[model samples]
Target: MFPSKDAPLKIGAFCSIAGQVRFMCSGQHPTDSATSFPIYSRLLKQPEPVANGGKPAGITVGNDVWIGNGAMILPGVEIGDGAVVGAGAVVTKNVPPYAVVGGSPARLIRYRFSEDVILQLLAIQWWRWDDEKIKREAAALTGPIETFIERHSVAGTATK
Candidate 1:
């Protein structure tokens, strides 16, 4: 949850958040407390106490991420770049960059590519490209990885 104005939820460029995807942003209620009712009064009368207390950290989604339909991304989870969240997955933790995650609480299925490839892609960060650049590299975007890399790799940057 982004309680602080400074730490707003960051969703990077080229993200695909499919229909019905849920983001649980705030978790201020204490489970051990007798009842959750008191927090509501606190919220209504004095906002500062509830705002500062026990709230979950903000969620961050990096560039080129794909969150599938019906997936639930919980509070404080940082979904990394190029990661894929499968349909119906309940993501409760941080997703590593370029990792494919699926299932309840979202366990890692596999990396989208090998470590070398991932490193290369991370270095490239093609999602940051301008519209013209992306359009120019349309073929590479849809083609095989080898070709994509070959065409776009330029001194460790993915730009023309």
Candidate 2:
């Protein structure tokens, strides 16, 4: 969360970020530069040279995202809704919605649900549900995805 007006870290509702998860997008040394050092920038008292061609960018973690402990989200990375970042993963790129990514330079491990179900869940958008409604649909919400989607989507209740 370095200070940069143009690079604002935005985390959406209901995200489960673990301890030491870093959302960094600014104050980085430029890899493209002759040296990955900011001594000149510091000596000159100027803006520190940054990655992404000196154009620092923001990071976005969407709703229901679960970022594990020690995961490092790099500059300009957009982690989509319902995605999971495994422990110690160094995410360097955009993660798709519902993607389960892990490892250095995070790779796609798997998706949380089938494509159709994911679309349905996205359409359901249960995170936006009111507290009372969520409490009322607790059983369905915590149950199997099929039952949850059936009761919520077809019956118009909610999804977990």
The prediction achieving the highest TM-score against the true structure is 2
C-alpha RMSD of each candidate structure in angstroms: 4.3, 4.1
Report backbone clashes per prediction: 0, 0
Q: Write the per-residue lDDT of candidate 2 for residues 80-143, one digit (tens) a residue.
A: 9999999999998999999999999899999999887887888888899999998999899888
Error (Å) of candidate 1 at residue 79 is 0.5
RMSD after Cα superposition, model 1: 4.3
24-140 in candidate 1: lDDT tens per residue?
665446555566554643666433243434445568899999999999887678999999999999988899999999999789999998787777788888988899999998888
Give me the runs in candidate 2 sitting further than 4 Å from their true place.
Answer: 35-52, 154-160
**Alpha-carbon lDDT, every model:** 0.78, 0.83
Count of backbone collisions in candidate 1: 0
Scored by lDDT, model 1 comes in at 0.78
Model 2: which ten-residue window has the lowest total lDDT? 151-160
